[model samples]
Target: MAYTGEVEVGGPPDVHELTDLIITKAAVGPMDNNAYVLRCRATDEQLLIDAAAEPHTLLEVIGADGIGAVVTTHRHRDHWQALAEVVAATGARTYAGRLDAPALPVPTDVPVDDGDTISFGRIRLTARHLVGHTPGSIVLVYDDPHGHPHVFTGDCLFPGGVGNTHDDPAAFTSLLTGVTAKLFDVLPDESWVYPGHGRDTTLGDERPHLAEWRERGW
Candidate 1:
């Protein structure tokens, strides 16, 4: 079947192929958190984004090839519930946004800042820091040489609007500003957005609603 980017907990993952990379997205945990397994086609080196839950399931998806690194998108418990177990099992190094690194259950091997690169095999993802969802929430961007760019947005950008800010105007403003400048303004509308939970969306699909999102203040 074609990749639809829609997954359910306990269901099969949706897989997409790129020129040098293969992305496998799975939904795990009661919260329905999304975990992405990226494999480099040339070297087969694997990197996991968010070991959210169900270590056994994640490990199974990883297979015997093993993973080289795990990157937690933020400090949220739901996003890293299985971090310790997965890391312990695969002996994978951990990476997170510098500001949110101290709060994770596992030690962050690399505290990343904006513009830092996370690499596995021949592929690299650029980290873009977007504040307000958390002090250091980040989205990973893979500028595919063969196709449109793909981004892994961790609890920051979703299908309808930005992440929840609990009604705090300042926080909402900060998130919206960062998302607009760093994401919408920079990336092309064809860029694919892989969010932390639920289904995926593209920049083109959400761009027109920026004003509405700002006015609604969510």
Candidate 2:
């Protein structure tokens, strides 16, 4: 309900908040990776997802209130470019999918497994491990007060199509299958999708495109 001035770093982010979650999103690094700061309104505790580039600016956005933990979306370089610095500065607990844990610059404090639950404030996020994007690609989900769910899907799903499989058909199939079943089939049309890069979209906007994404074999 309360709006504040933009937390400008790369540029002013498109902010979104409903009920307990306040999302501060910004583009960072060479890839223009999206890094998000998710704050729990009641507890004032934060969980940072994909601590991409621009360490100083990311820390500046964090400001006085420190983060509770830093969750790496995947082992990709662009995603965690600033993970070490941000975690070192905030001393926030670091989490990565167990399979991708060893590849990170900083050792993961918590190696999350599929279906694992991450506790923060009064709610918990369920990790849906969707492989092929990486052996450990994950999407975090929890219900919002408005009835729609808020999903942080790293590079697995995007606006128009699924993430690049680097021409690997098997990976493309695996990721697409996982996304279709675990996300689209389960969540409501109103579910908000905050991806690892680019703009945000809702399930309602993307559901109709699934068949198209599949037909093209992207």
Candidate 3:
């Protein structure tokens, strides 16, 4: 999709497959929040993550494709600024962790708890509740049958350290603890990290510096 200078829409209009899943990515809003479309090739059911901004572009990116659900990674306004618009346009059910669901502008059809499994077609994503950035912040883990795992961390685990803690020591500890235990310790080093904003990174690239991140403390 050609989005011109304002927004960069990367991925095929038809389908971009990774193993049995098809993924589409678009960077939207001034903040450049990533909006992802994940499809199960076997059934074509799709789940959209973070409809940050640019309703027209988001709706267009979704195109004629039917959306099974929309998940907002957290309660942050930047992440779901365009959520109401997208849901209105597509009629897709909305989901977020129970702790964070109350924060959204729209209603949630499903309150995703940690370890909750969301399945469509042959694709299954397990929700990992990683707190700190937000009380109910979640990371979706997809164990790709073909290769390594794929974890979509909203704003928790970035390429550098954990997501910004804004000098809140307690919050930082909460977020980093989740990242270290729930993510780093459990997931493989080869796990692909799809963040809420900016580019993607791998658990392998950010793991070795855990001690460094802890000592400095954001």
- What is the lDDT of every predicted structure here? 0.96, 0.85, 0.85
Q: Candidate 2: minimum summed lDDT over ten consecutive residues — where?
A: 1-10
Rank the models by lDDT, top first: 1, 2, 3
TM-score of each: 0.99, 0.94, 0.92
TM-score of 3: 0.92
Model 1: lDDT to the true structure: 0.96
Residues 13-128, candidate 1, lDDT per residue (tens digit)? 88998889999999997899999999999999999999999999999999999999999999999999999999999999999999999999989999999999999999999999
Q: Candidate 3, overall lDDT?
A: 0.85
Minimal lDDT window, size 10, model 3? 2-11
Q: Give the higher-lDDT candidate: 1 or 2.
A: 1
In order of TM-score, best first, we have 1, 2, 3
Between 1 and 2, whose TM-score is larger? 1
**Candidate with maximal TM-score:** 1
Give the Å shift of residue 83 in candidate 1.
0.2
Please say which candidate is ahead in lDDT: 1 or 3. 1
